[model samples]
Target: MHRFVVIGGGAGGLELATRLGDAFGARRRNPQATVTLIDRNPTHIWKPLLHEVAAGSMDPYTHQLEYAAQAYWHGFEFQQGELTGIDRAAHTVTIAAVDDDTGREMLPSRSIRYDTLIIAIGSTTHFFNVPGADAHAFALDTVAEAERFRRRLIAACTRAESNDDALRAQGALPTHKRHRVQIAIVGGGATGVELSAELRNTAQVLSAYGLHGLDPRDDIGIVLIESGPRLLPALPERVSTETARLLEARAIDVRLGERVTEVAEHAVRTASGRDIPVDLTVWAAGIKAPRVLSTLDGLTVNGLGQLNVRPTLQTELDDDIFALGDCAACVWPTTGRNVPPRAQAAHQQAEFLFRAMRDRLSGRPLRAFEYRDLGSLVSLGHVTAVGNLMGGLIGGTMFIDGLFARIMYMSLYRMHIAALHGIPRMLLDTLAHWLRRRTVPRVKLH
Candidate 1:
């Protein structure tokens, strides 16, 4: 029997493992392949939702997938470990041991051999070596990190409200002079834009709960700083312009073409030597493949540490090894551009690899990967959404907004759920989520 091991239980990796297990690992009597999935974390959550989680607009636990349970249900073996290194000559991967809460070793370091190896170990936040960025700015890269940011946001709001109460008691000024809480987000990408909007809604929700003394609309300030001339540089120019308009209408301070030179303890310093004081700072500027990729035992990688893969998504030097998602640097031949690291791109790659791996097992040729631009959507909490749809009925890209675009934006995540848990489970999960929201606070308090 062929042994297949996939490292990383991210969006692309988890979906690939699920499909492969359903087909080959489901039947024990005549199994075509022994599928195993390895991940550092015990659970999986969609990476894009990290922004919502950070803003406390969404509870992550409801959407998290337990790797052990998912693996059992889908007929795949789950191994909890992190990749230490890969031995291309030996066709094996080294998994480092995991420690328990008390720092005791729970799992011993081991090596797993594979006939077919797929490396979908996703990317990490790239700080660009900006001074003080790594220390002062909060990054939403994992569940723990997002939760930490949410806590800080809650604390900042509470502190500001208390300060306002003290000022009022001393008759410093009228209620019109509201206490202000400032947040500085560095980046104009979807994560930064969406997070800013979500944070605004979060402040409103807190005010409604009597957690803050000042009016949310007047006192909560969000400043988005982008080095580029516009936000959402990857999307259409119109989308960026309209997004900027909407954000400004909500009173968000949008600073463009202002590069952040450094991040201080309580502020963001821009290129013009302007020190914008902020109570909370978040960095969502850029991404690069995990540092482990660069030391992958001679695997050629780009400057960003992404593995150089062929059109077939296979590593340059190894035919049996494949990669995708944020870690693999695959080119879009049509546009002569590296495929953008978007959820849609990851979904497309996973779908292609699903067929490609099956073909490999059956002694057939694998086809090349193609990145389809299904357009992009930036969701402004629940007020509205903006994006374009590719190859619409009008024969070209059709720009859309409002309710229609919101539905389209949501369907992207639903599609990912379907790929992992099937349509029936995905629908049930969605319904449950909707019902749960009605009974809980709009935003997490603690």
Candidate 2:
């Protein structure tokens, strides 16, 4: 039996393991292969939804997939540990064990050998060595980080509401006579943009609970800073324009062409010599692969820590190894640029690798992976969404907005859930969430 080990149970890795287990694990008495999946977290949350989680608009428990339970149902084995190092010569992976939240010693630091290894460990926030950023700013990279931001946000609001007199005496009050919480998001990409909008909506809901004189539109201030010349610069110009208009309409101060040179306790300094006073600072600007990527033996990574992969998605230095997702640098032939790091691209890469792995086992020629640009979509809270879609089957780009775009944006998430839990479970989960949301407060109160 082939010992197939997949590291990082993320969007791409988890989906691949599930499909492989379902196909190979449910055989007669004997199984064709053994599939093992390892992850730092016991539960999986889709990365794209991290912003919503951070903004307190979504609950992590409701969306998380328990890796152990998922493995039991899908015919795979789940091991929880943090990857520390790798030995290519020994074909082994080193993992460090620790106590779980329940104070149980799960596993010790150990090594696992694999016939085939796949690395899908996603990227992490790169603070660019900005002073005080790592210590002060909130990052929406994981559930813990998101939850931390939400807690601080609620506390900040409560402080403002209860201490209005002191704040007013300090002349912080605007002409509108509303209590305010100033939040600065230091990135204008989809994550920062979506999070600003989500926070605006959720903060409004939070104010209804005796949050005296707090008005989201008038009081809660959201400032988005982008170093680039425009928002969503990677997308179409029209998309950027539409996004800017939507954000502006929501009273979000979108500061274009502004770079943060320094971060302090209560403010951020721009390159153009301006101090933006803010109570909460969020760093969503830049990202690179985990620093561990650079130390992996026999693997070639770009300066960004992305593993350099061939057209077949195999590591340039090691054919027995494969990589995908935000960590892999797979170039696009048409644009001569590396494939954009997106969930859609990751999903496609995993699908391609599924076939390629089968061919490798069968001693046949493996097919190369190609990225298909399916346009982009950005949701501006619950109010609106905008983007374009393009697939070879659909001919040219198709414009979408409003409710139509919202549904499409949601479908992307549903597709991820469906891949893991199947249609019946995914539909049931969706229904349960919708019903629960209608009954509970929109923002997390605790």
Candidate 3:
């Protein structure tokens, strides 16, 4: 009986685990193989949606998948623990004990032996050691962090309004020019751009709740700061230009080529020694693999802490151990560029590895992982979206905006769901969410 364990219940790992379970978990009588998934969190949510969650535009609970429930439905065992280390020689993974809320030791620190191991622990925000960034700026990495940011946004708006009221009661000019909550979003990547737009939209939604006469275009100021010369530097030139145009039209101040030297409690100091005052700051700049990856006993990692994997997605030192997603450095065959750490690339890699694992189990040669060049998409809230279609599907460099790009961006998440739960279940969940959305408030006011 083969024992397979997948670490990290992220987009790539979760989907692959579900597929493997469906294939192996149902057969009870014929010496069925055991499949287990381990994650720190009890639930899983698409990482890209963290921006929306941070802006309070989407209810995360509705989108989150309970690991225990999904594991039960898909016929796999779900272990609630964090991986501390792996022993390749012993074919075992050491999991740290999870301390319960009541100070009880629910699960002891233990080792689980596996015939195959997949590491997909994902990445975290790279602050670049900017002064005060760790203490002042909010990062959108986890559901908890997003929710915290959302609450802070709402509170800032409320506090600004109250401050204005206090000045009014003191017999000052009614519109005596008080700055509203000014948000500074550092990093011009998709997460930073998308979050800025979503925050603006959420401000509009929040205005109805006692923010009388507050003009989104005037009172609420959003500044997107990028160290590079243009936004979305990784995307095509046209995509960045078009995106900048759309954002500027919405009254968002796009500051390009400005390096942030420091982050203060209420301001971001730029390399040019300009201190831009802000009420709320969000740092979406850069990313690096989880710190744990660098310390893996027999793994070689780059400066970014990403494990160096072969073309087959297996660790260079161990064939039984594989890695994917943001934590794995998989080289591109043609361009010689390591594959970009994007969700689409991770999904594609997961599917390839899934098939390769089954082949290896059946005494067949594993196929090399090939990366497909899928152009990027950036969603600027409900205002607009921009992207370039790849695979020559829409010809060379098709710059799409408005509805088309929005639909394309959404389909990416839908595709991930389809991979995990099948098309029928994904469609049902989509329809259910749509209907529920109509009856709920746009923002999570609570």
Candidate 4:
């Protein structure tokens, strides 16, 4: 039987492995292939929702999908380890030993031979080499980072409230003096914009829960600093304008055309010498593929460290090795540029690869992958969203906003779930979450 090894249990990788296993794993009487998925984390969460996780709007525990459970249900194998190296000539990949929280070894290092290898480890936040940025600012690239920010947010609010109360009791609380928590978000992309909106709601929920004494609207300040002229530069300008208007209407401080030069312990300094005092800083400026991609046995990579791939999604240097998602630099013939690194693009690549792999097994000719632009959506809190829908069916781009747009934004996640577990399970999962929402706080408190 052919052995297929996939590194990374991200959205695209996990979905592809599940499909391959279902079609060719041991469960089938005449199994043709064995699928194995490796990931550093035991569970998987959608990358786009990391902002919600950071803002405490989403409880990650309730939504995380355990890889072991997924593998058991889908006829695939799960390996918990980080990719250390890949040997192209030997047709094997080395996995580093994994250690528990207490520094005890959980799994020893091992090598897995594969007839075909797929790399989809995803991307990480790029800080643009700003001084003190990497050391002080937080990046929402993983669950742990998001959770850390959430905890710090709760602590900051609590500390500010306590300080205000102490000042009041000591008769030192002046009428004009108000304790505040200021958050500085660097970037105006989807992650930054979405996070800013979510943070606003989080502040209100925190106040409603009696977790803080400061006024949510006035005492909690969210400053969004963008080097570009507008927010969501990748989206239509109309969407950007509307998104800016929505955020500004919520009292968020949207600073445009100002590049951050440095990040200090308590503030962010801009090129204009403006210092924005902050209790916390989040870096969502940009993204680059993992550094490991460059060291992968002489695989050709672009300046951003993304593995260069042909239109077929096969690496330029090797046919047995493939890459997808944020890690691959696959060209878009329509735009003459690499496909934008988005969840939609990743989903499309996974679907294409599934069909391509099947064709290869049957000795049939493989088709080139073509990416379709379905437009984009930017979520503004829980009640509103701004974006445009594009397609031949729409005859052009149609702008949408308000509650309808928010629903459409949410449906993207639902569609991802359906891809992995089918429509019935996705529907059941949605119903279960809806019921659970009524019994719990809208935002996570702890």
TM-score of each: 0.97, 0.95, 0.96, 0.98
Candidate 1 regions off by >4 Å? 26-29, 171-179, 392-395
Better candidate by TM-score, 2 or 4: 4
Tens-place lDDT digits, model 1, residues 73-191: 98899999999999989989999999999999999999999999999999999999999999999988999999999998888888887876788799894554423788999999999
Candidate structures ordered by lDDT, highest first: 4, 1, 3, 2
Clashes of each: 0, 0, 0, 0
Q: Positional deviation of 44 in candidate 3, in angstroms?
A: 0.4
Task: Please provide, for model 3 over 56-153, each residue's C-alpha lDDT reduced to its tens digit, 9 standing for 90 to 100.
Answer: 98899999999999888888888988889988899999888988889899888888999999998999999999999989999888999999988888
Worst 10 residues of 3 by lDDT: 24-33
Candidates' lDDT values, in order? 0.90, 0.87, 0.88, 0.93
Give the Cα RMSD of candidate 4. 1.1
Clashes of 1: 0
Best by lDDT: 4
- lDDT, candidate 2, 282-387, per-residue tens: 9999889988888888688998999999998889988889999999999999999999889998899888888877787788988889889988999888757888
Which ten contiguous residues of candidate 4 have the minimum total lDDT?
A: 171-180
**RMSD, each candidate, Å?**
1.7, 2.2, 1.7, 1.1
Assess the local accuracy of residue 77 in candidate 4 as a C-alpha lDDT between 0 and 100: 93
Tens digits of per-residue lDDT, candidate 4, 28-107, equal 78889999999989999999999999999899999999999888888889999999899999999999899999999999
